[model samples]
Target chain A: MLKKDPNFTRLKKLGGRGYLGRVSYWLGVDHLLVVEVTNYNERYRRFYFRDLQAVIVQRNRNRMWGNIVAGVIAILPALGALALLSDGEYAGASLVGGILVLIGIFILSNTLRGPMCSVHLRTAVQTQKLANIDRWRRAEFLIETLTPLIQSLQVSAGEAQSPNPATVSNPPAASAVQPDFS
Target chain B: MSTASNNVLNCPNCGKSLSDLPEMLPAVERCPACERQTRVVVFPAFSRPVVKGATAEAVMMEGEATCFYHAKKRAQVPCDECGRFLCAVCDLEVNGRHLCPQCLETGAKKGKVQSLERGRFRWDQVISTLLVLPLISCGFLLPLTSLAALVLVVWKWKSPPSLVHNTRLSLIVCGVLALIEFIGGCAFWWFMLFGSRRY
Candidate 1:
């Protein structure tokens, strides 16, 4: 429901704090529905369930952080090897150090490249939950607005269909001619 | 809104039209014209889609009528080799394909399975320790501190159960570097301090 709103488009375009602010606002709405409602079994299915697209976006964003960290790790080995080469005395120690540093850098780089969807899946689920809460709120508003119209229809129908006036009158002899109010 | 009857279904006994009957009521109901209870049954009654079959325990049969696994108590999956019944739990997803439990067991015992052991290690710490170890022998305190750093890196690398290869590599590198640093430092001290005095 939040995604459908034009305001979301504007917020997304704004970027920076605006994007983060919109996401947090939607998250708050989702949190409210999760906490307040007790009977909506379909809420999770309709709103909070993780879809594939959302999962992919989340993973892509998360991997950027891992990549940056890996890049930083890669720097260490290069720097260490350079330092060891400059110090000619500890040649044996330097070789072992160089190998270990290089291996660590390789592992970090490999892990950064590998496929990881856990982070993305988690964020998608959260977003879906927020959307479900927004849908529930709209459904409640419709019900509240329509209830009075239904009651009016019931009253009008009752007035039109009453038993014949001649049979089983309210008072035994009270006629239209007298119209007494005692 | 109301529409004209698409097809007139009349009661057999009274010939009274049954098309105007309420949608909520069963299609076959008593005809007032006959003053007796009668039914107007249709071949394809206007009921919701029948997702389950007549048995109700299994899904409605579709193209090719696959067998249902009574033991597993699920449906819609067929074995790869033989088109027999197999539920998802009983099905093995292998090498871009689905194989039944029997096939999976045979394949596993035949050593046709891939070992999934992707390990994690702190590459930064290992590299740092190794690099620092060689520098340790330049001064007595440098080697001591670098040895401590190497021990820490090895410990951290070995903590996780998955990444043994990466951890072992780092450990070996750090240990050898530390040993070399200690021995080289001792040799240098002996040559400078004692060799000159003896001469």
Candidate 2:
């Protein structure tokens, strides 16, 4: 049987984008998880092995409409510039067209990225979304690593509370069959 | 990858090992060994320390600044909100914002700061509700109520942010409803004058 250790080591670093699009990291611990939302704010939540209700991983695909709308808005000025140039306004046409094309490229590059995966820890009190663990591989690895430790902890906790097997099995057969009101 | 049998969880009521439990948590199962029931909950484990090289340094000299929360501890950083010097233990960093416990608590209670807030009041939804509901129940006061709703929508267009990502659907609905009411009022007035003359 494995003994419980008080000194916790970080098993995994979950990384994700935080508020105002800042990259943040969280520390996965055996009994406690520390989420660093920003430079000054950190949330620490402790859970017993028997208290954690669920660990959920959800995949969110990038919305194409946002990219499409951005692309369309970006090209609007360029299209307007084309109309102006056809009407013999060369200066206005060139300036607007150049700016719009650059803006469009910038939006397109950012929007071309793949979907993001998010990890969530649900307990009796509340469900916390681990913003830092956004990648599927990392999230999966965290789940895999923690499952055994949780199982071990549960087993140990259970054993500590349970009565001896020998004592339980050796009860008199007559006493087991008879219902005691007391 | 470790198999289920490698670290089998036992029933809390019984010493018997439980095998093949479902992945979903908060499950109730009868222990075969003891004929008693137990609820199974699971948590992930950590093998290493998450925060590396984070240790509270001692206050060395008498002249050096000390933490406001802990006077004996050496001050490492200043709280972003209150500008109070904080030790390593007192400095709570959230999304690049360094804050002391007092400021954190205050921000959470008042909902002034977005990072500290758990939920937010959606003004757009309020505006939309006010605009649409008045028109349905009080058709006679459509012009007055819708105008007031429009004014509110414009005034509180950028009120407190929502807990979840908002698409401004409520604002759009309010705008549409307000416009319809305004146009209907104008049409009604026009008909009252011109149609009366025609009759």
Candidate 3:
């Protein structure tokens, strides 16, 4: 008999781009595993589908902050380039602005990635914040992907608990509506 | 399980109650208290009751063994690690192991429980840094650094490896590079002193 290994396996790379440690998601038969890997340590947090209560996503100002910093960095060089161009020193102007294209790339990419947001998961006693899911699209993707799995698992458990889902007649999670900002 | 687990969805920022606007959820809703924009995804468990935990039962028979901790309660099962008798209240089921409190504590302290491991020191990083630092910054100290790397590879061979990366390959590569660097450094020094003095 061919038997599948009943263990947490690698899943989609759900957003967790940490500065010091990278947090990645894994999937098991009944739970979602969040592993944070640092240079010296590996921390684990598991959220079972049956116990998952809610997913809260909040808008953040990451891109705005990032662009503001990039703008500050680009200012001095931009002024220098303009002064050189006014003096007809095209060589100096190009040289000054050429390297500062790094700021342009940063701003463009950040803007194209869309608005940044933070996703949080709440259970009965614990509310975990996933700072890694910073982008709006990633937050939406995370919620969209997890809703069905959690809903199905809860429905099966509810079936086992009672014959009809009188309590779950109007399951909010089962019919999760997506926000445009997610 | 508590009904709070299923029916409660509060503002993540100000911790204010948003229960009155429950129908407008899974959308961008500004909190009245903090006025910060929030989007909440309510799952099935948001409306479901909390799953109740197993409760301890009274003694079933006169001849039945009593719990080790509780004199009046029935002994339901034996601990997986220590073989101690545990009642319903005392028997903590984790990964199918009906362990007593003491056994669970001991196992956690010793890192015997895989699920309880929070972190591990990456010996691979230590050894790799030892081998590579001198080569990039101080070429003259390469021999000594290589020897230290080699020694660390042998010393921490049985230590816990990195969970994110393949560590055995790193250890092997570090050991090999260290061996070659040490041998090359020794040979170069030997030739510089003796070979140059050839009469």
**Regions of candidate 2 where Cα sits further than 4 Å from its true position:** A1-182, B1-41, B45-60, B69-72, B80-83, B95-97, B102-115, B161-169, B186-199
lDDT of 2 by residue, B79-176 (tens): 99999999988888865698998998898788666444443455665566666676678766667767777887778776654322242666767778
lDDT by residue for model 3 (A44-128), tens: 7778887887888777677899999999989999999999999999999999988689789989999998888777898988888
Candidate 2 overall lDDT versus native: 0.56
Q: Which ten residues in a row have the lowest lDDT in candidate 1 chain A?
A: A171-180
The candidate, 1 or 3, that scores higher on lDDT is 3
Q: Rank the candidates by TM-score, best first.
A: 3, 2, 1
Per-residue C-alpha lDDT of model 2 across residues A1-182, encoded as one tens digit per residue: 00122354454355456563333332234354443333323333444454454455544433355566777777778689989989999999989978887877766664554334556665544556665565555666666666666666645654674543433222111100111113
What order do you get sorting by DockQ, best first? 3, 2, 1
lDDT of 1 by residue, B1-199 (tens): 1212223334433456534643312333334465333222121112211122123134344443444545524455677756667654556566556677776776555534422111123453454555565564447554455556556655665454211123456556766766676566667767787988888
Please say which candidate is ahead in DockQ: 1 or 3: 3
Q: Candidate 3 falls in which docking quality class?
A: acceptable
Q: What Cα-based lDDT does every candidate model obtain?
A: 0.38, 0.56, 0.76
The DockQ scores of all candidates, in the order shown, are: 0.02, 0.04, 0.47
TM-scores for the candidates: 0.23, 0.40, 0.84
Which lDDT tens digits does candidate 1 get at residues A54-152?
111111223445556656766766576667667764775477576766667666664544432211111211322222112212323322332233223
- lDDT of predicted model 1: 0.38
